[model samples]
Target chain A: MRYMEDTLLHHLHTNDTEALKTFLFTIEELPLLQVFTSLSANEKAIVFRLLPKDKALALFEALQPTAQHHLLRSFTDEGATEFFNDMAPDVRVRLLDELPASVTKKLLQSLTASERDATNLLLGYERETAGRLMTPEFITLKKEMTVEDALAKVRLQAREKETIYTLYVTDQRKKLHGVLSLKELLIAEGSQLIADIMSHEVIYVATDTDQEEAARLLNEIDVIALPVVDRESLIVGIVTADEGRHILEDEAIEDMF
Target chain B: MRYMEDTLLHHLHTNDTEALKTFLFTIEELPLLQVFTSLSANEKAIVFRLLPKDKALALFEALQPTAQHHLLRSFTDEGATEFFNDMAPDVRVRLLDELPASVTKKLLQSLTASERDATNLLLGYERETAGRLMTPEFITLKKEMTVEDALAKVRLQAREKETIYTLYVTDQRKKLHGVLSLKELLIAEGSQLIADIMSHEVIYVATDTDQEEAARLLNEIDVIALPVVDRESLIVGIVTADEGRHILEDEAIEDMF
Candidate 1:
């Protein structure tokens, strides 16, 4: 891997796109991110430019928040918009929070309306609150459904969901009633009611709850996802295991800096 | 919350078990764990002794590993046994790793034969590797079964599983062939074969892969559990998102001290 890292640098130095592509294809995302970040700023840009769109997005997400901030400054406005548009909402806000106000304003305006609303809703919360980190893209279920019906709902909507693993059971008022993992749904008899299998003890965090506290609870309980609710206990968004991980990774990086 | 914290502490000082229980019932696990941990050693013992068995076990698991270490030494043998006997396998190893050799040896003998074997497998691995943290408790499947048959298998076998959310499809030789999330299983038509719905792309790690790396992959992909394989490519164990959280928590606590 070290040999490949060096070779990647050598390829970048010589402008050998074919050699770099061969090397990158031979490695995994973790190693690719490592090699890309280990390069000098100019080399990093060159390598990043050469990456395919999906790989580029993955690499961008994998970069340290500081590294991401640096790249934001270096990219053309169109390039920045492309990256920002695909990035996770929390990630986009975190990067924006670190840049100069003038720069952030210009970048922020380029976001599409729905993305802007989602990002702004999170940003409106306190810096380290659950609202700031929770993704608004979760799917919800209704209690009036059978296991088969819920399954159909999840299938139709699951593609766009941040997580369909833990489906929230909510009322017409959007108030949470119970929580159910897809495991329970899968194992249940098809005609069985979701309410019969769903657990009523839904562990949730308020929108204003501290992010670390929420993440810690999420971890301790070993749930793949936790619901974030408003003060009235209506489901608003969901904080996922990945976001909890990103918090830890960002903290570790912060410690080193 | 501050008032409740103060009131609980005061009640503990006054030996007010009734008031304390009332206060505890009104609050959630996160705050209860925090308030309990903040108490004096004498008070902690008093409160712990007063706690119901389930709550005590929860508190024991919620503690920082070092605090768990101190409690092991501080408690009477009977008290310590109750705590140790049911602690999660990976957590047991972590706590035992921090104790004196003689203490660990004595405690090691108390575990059931199967638990001892599982812990020893993890102990045999290098620190920070997947083998050290991977749990031996997991459910595997075969691809030839119908969804209904698989669901029945899951229902019968699910209780002992560390996770049934991400089911592995293995061949006759116990070689993993594909992966299927419970979501996919739930949404599929009941008569369909498991092979038809299961994904061929399985993201996994060898037993010796870095725990953090495997964990990062699991988190990035937002899977409930990650399978750990041996050199022979047979599934050995699974590492869970909760365990990932535990690893990060341990790291954060280590940095603090």
Candidate 2:
């Protein structure tokens, strides 16, 4: 298991912060996550505090919710907000679901308006449904848009969207009509309309659709992303394959405990 | 849990093959899998027998291996050979790993030579590692190739390759150089060399690296496929995100049991 309590832990105890940072940086993220689990609560705190802010945030977000709760308990309100607010919407929702009601309420109040709204939308949907697991930051393009125009739109909007791997084409009313992969867009003639080349067979999930079924479809089809829609059949968010993986893993962890 | 015992089960009871096939056609694959789980032993055999050959193959491959074992017991050796030889490589390996040594031997003998070789390669590695989960059907391209050339290669090899989302470029001795997404290739000028456009941060797993760790890396990075390497850092096979999701789900099911 490579559970060797080597000089790296020794470096943390010896108060050699420089050596400790160097050593920790050399270890990959998953192994680092494991290493933190093995430390004394005090040792964990000491080592966690010594990490650079970016590394600490990345490592903290990767942790299971119970471990995250323990770490959050040690933080002041401002410290907690900074850490919690930076997490992906789905992960943030999961952490909030686990924390005390009062903490969740306060954390909700502390978030930026948009992040708070997205989390609320996900939470409002019934648990164990696609709505609860979707990320709200999805890009929607018009069905009539040219491939050239669509690619430009994606480039401009890509940073805010969770995934550009798969894009949806909706009518003016936001009803999803077709789906296109970024690969297809890149390969198409620039003058061709998205609707001409996009696959009209829209494999999607409704807001209240079962999450396990969604995960199964995502895995079975091997699509990098799938669109989630509300009752109006308007696109609301995306459930990336990566998030699908996390949902399955989290459920597995739940089974273990 | 839509556990309605409706007229479809009625059709099965009455031996109404036409009605049962018609009703089953209206159901989706995932729900069909769940329905199969609820059937009694004799009922399962009757319903499974009524399915068309293609539908039967898909349904059988999606089943849990233990359930598959039960079905195999009821089949003639010739019938079992037809069913066992058609599963995806990793799924086949997993089934082999679970069954009695004698059953595994018989199935391995019945497989095509190429499929047998691939199975042996994956089995040669320690279980619960990237090697065990990876499929050797990945498409490789050279760093010197133009974007046009690479895309052409992808189209020709797409049917056999596990994933076309991410492609790796290797040097003369098969030493890994960099990675480029198909999206990047599609958007780039067709004449550009792959080495010019690829990212140097090659996220990969060694052959004996832990499977859970590999799954985590694939999820965290949101990559559809990852390179699996031999001891000298040569790419041997690719592990797709689909496999990553299954590995996590299977582990979760194990924990629940």
Q: Which candidate has the highest TM-score of all?
A: 1
What is candidate 1's lDDT per residue for B1-257, written digit by digit as tens? 67767898787666555666666556667777878777665556445544543565567778887886655444333433344445465644443322222222333334444554434432335567887677656667888999889877886776656588789998865577899976677667779999999999998897679887887787577777888776557776788877876776677689999
Docking class of 1: incorrect
**Chain B TM-score (each prediction, in order):** 0.53, 0.54
Task: Supply candidate 2's per-residue lDDT for B64.
Answer: 79
Q: Which of the CAPRI classes, incorrect, acceptable, medium or high, describes model 2?
A: incorrect
Global CA lDDT computed for model 2: 0.65
| Superposition TM-score, candidate 2 onto the true structure | 0.46
How close is candidate 1 at the interface, in terms of C-alpha RMSD after superposing the true interface residues?
3.4
Stretches of candidate 1 off by over 4 Å are A1-128, A187-193, A210-213, A255-257, B1-133, B145-152, B187-197, B207-222, B244-257
lDDT of 2 by residue, B88-147 (tens): 555444433222222333333344445544444323355688876777666678988998
Model 2's i-RMS, to one decimal, reads 5.1
Can you write out model 1's per-residue Cα lDDT over A57-159, one digit (the tens) per residue? 6777776778876654444334324434555656444433222222223333344435544444313354678876777666778888998898778877766
